[model samples]
Target: MSDVNATSVRAIATKDFRDAVRSWTFWGLSLLFFLLVGLAAFAIGYFGNADTSTADFLGTVSQVTRLVVPLIALLLGWKSIAGERESGSIKVLLSLPHSRIDVVLGKYLGRATVLSLSLLIGFVIGAVVVAVMLSPPAIADYAGFIAMTILYGIAYLGIAIALSSITKSTTIAGAAMFGVFVLFYVVWNLLNFALQILMNQGYFSGVEVTQTMNGNEMQYERLPDWGLFVQTIDPGVAYANALSVIDAVEAPGFGTAFSAELFPSGVPFYLQNWFSFLILLVWIVVPTAIAIARFDRVDL
Candidate 1:
């Protein structure tokens, strides 16, 4: 691979970003996010009782975005490189003063920027509506949610872009994207159940813990720390955990009997909320790094 030239990378990124903005996909994402936030705001105003706060509203929105943003990112990036190769456009890009590594980096940054901007626009519009309807929202919490949401989208975008790079056929890339969606949303959730099965069959040992409820002692077998760590590594789970830290909003099970018993001596470093941020960073970095290495060696 040719030496990476910062100038070439920037030039390609700028061109790609501008080209993407001109496409309908960019505007569509903005509108979708806007509508999503608008609906959240409407629900909060019409249905929420006196117990609700700005954190509650943002948390509810985060839950929706956690599922939707990945789909948008996958659709946006599924064809970024593979489509170009199939259409003979990749040659034109390569013929310029750019290396394969440069193309990969530039495409990732450009698409990441597009996704981030679309998210920001939607969040801003939603914030405006939310501020007017709700008592002045918590600016810091809202900002953190937006920032985290962008990071979440970028992680998925990296996965999508990497999958796009390894294939010459859009069909394969499309399938890869679908596979990723299922891997995270479906398979990740089943991991805990699978772990339980293993424990039940004596493959993995469960930790014995005791709990007292209503002056009655109960004994139960919980998954080991390593097992719980594995569950939290999922990007969506990490995102939710990270939000609980930043937003100061107790998530559904925060300080609950189950959670307290799960970490009797305090949460492990790997299972803590801060670690989720690192997990997210890894999701963004590792996939792109692998793709860069592979794409550089491939006969594109």
Candidate 2:
């Protein structure tokens, strides 16, 4: 087994990026993002009153992005290493003095760059159009939202790539991607609901907090801090919660809103809005780390 070589990693990354850039998937994603932002702008400018700003536009678009970005990242990564291995191109790739670790790192860098560039193109154009349409707020916040969105997208991409690296079967990799989609969007939500049911049934404990909504005090049994941590396990939830931390969003939302109301006695460290970023970072790291370790030890 060869050690990771910087030059080899760079070569592989550049080649991978060049190859991907020429594909329809790359252009299609870029066009999709451009259209996503354009549509978001149209929605706000057409139906909204004076209160609408770029932040509102971002929040609206982010809702769609949460669903779209992960799917796109998964699709883009579905064939990354698995297809190459299936076709025996992994042999040819390794013959070029690139270590397996380099291959994983390089592929990740290449694809991550592709997604980031595609997002930048769309957001740049959208920002220009947004300036013409809405009462634009500070560009700093909008940039922060774009940055966070990019990080969110990268986290999903890393997960997909990690899955891609583990198996030689593209079919299995594709199935894994779908499974991931189901786990996060469906099962993750179900887990939260199930916890709520348990809390209501007194099977699980939660802090009863009184929140003033509609100027009326309403008592609610909120999830315990640990249960709340479980909800933030989803990348989308982390993205939204982190968005609130940077003031990129107006509301702290993702099923549960983070407010003093939810934690009258002060919020726990793990449930803090800023902690969501750490959660996202962990997702990005842990998956790839698993892939590299497992992939390296496995027979090609």
Candidate 3:
């Protein structure tokens, strides 16, 4: 790109970033994330007890991020583009000589930077709590979690931008973005439930057997194993991958596995997690591409 174009793009991005940061919403959200991190750490460390291992402490931290960070990202990003359009500034901004690609990418980067800072602060607070309670976390673990959070934040930003690009009102865009989160977060569980119910209905069972025991004697039992596949298809499985990365410090205890373990197989090596990660990437890239395309053709 020419220096002039580069300068224009940067100028646009800088103005957006400044406007975003200056808004009360940004600081409020950042403070909320900060408080959440501190509270999550306190809850985990206090309830987890002083004897909780570093691994467990960090695992709790990861859980907090997985469940909480996305909401913060959504709040930060849901209106990035749509808000501009609502205020009638989008046309003026797009009138610049820079391509829509530059505008879209630069806006994404600027908002993402703000989100990264908030997430970083929250994570650091959690880490401090972990260190005070147990051994410090490994640098590798911190690096991996940070990378994952960034990728996830980027994914949310893409979704928000797409929603904004298509809608003319910020209120509508915000609603749509929240709708997306609700669909992803809740619909996945409902799908899993339906799959599990179907599997348990015995449609796949080719044979049925009952086990009876006399004294210490036991008899063999047989049933269809197709239920496992249904479990794998559940979108909640992605959350399991996030958990695995967070829990990488050590495998959960057998006791932990016997009851309510997240990802019993631990990040499913046979392409399930890999597939979900790819889907998430697509979710990020496709909307972003569309937003860029629309911006290019838009009258603004």
- On lDDT, the leading prediction is 2
Alpha carbon lDDT of each predicted model: 0.85, 0.87, 0.62
Largest TM-score belongs to which candidate?
1
lDDT winner between candidates 1 and 3: 1
TM-score of 3: 0.74
TM-score of each: 0.94, 0.94, 0.74
TM-score of candidate 1 versus the correct structure, residues matched by position: 0.94
Question: Candidate 2: which pairs clash?
Answer: none
Question: 2 or 3, which is superior by lDDT?
Answer: 2
lDDT of 3 at 185: 74
Mind giving the per-residue lDDT tens digits that candidate 1 earns over 96-126? 8889999999998898999999999998988
- lDDT tens readout by residue for model 3, 41-146: 6676777765666555556555656666667667766777778778887767767776666777778777877777766766676577656655576767766666
- Cα error, residue 109 of model 1, in Å, equals 0.6
Give the candidates in order of lDDT, highest first. 2, 1, 3
How many angstroms is residue 194 displaced in model 2 relative to the true structure, after the best TM-score fit? 1.2
In the predicted model 1, the residue pairs found to clash are: none
Candidate 3 segments whose C-alpha is farther than 4 A from its true place: 1-8, 197-236, 242-276, 298-300
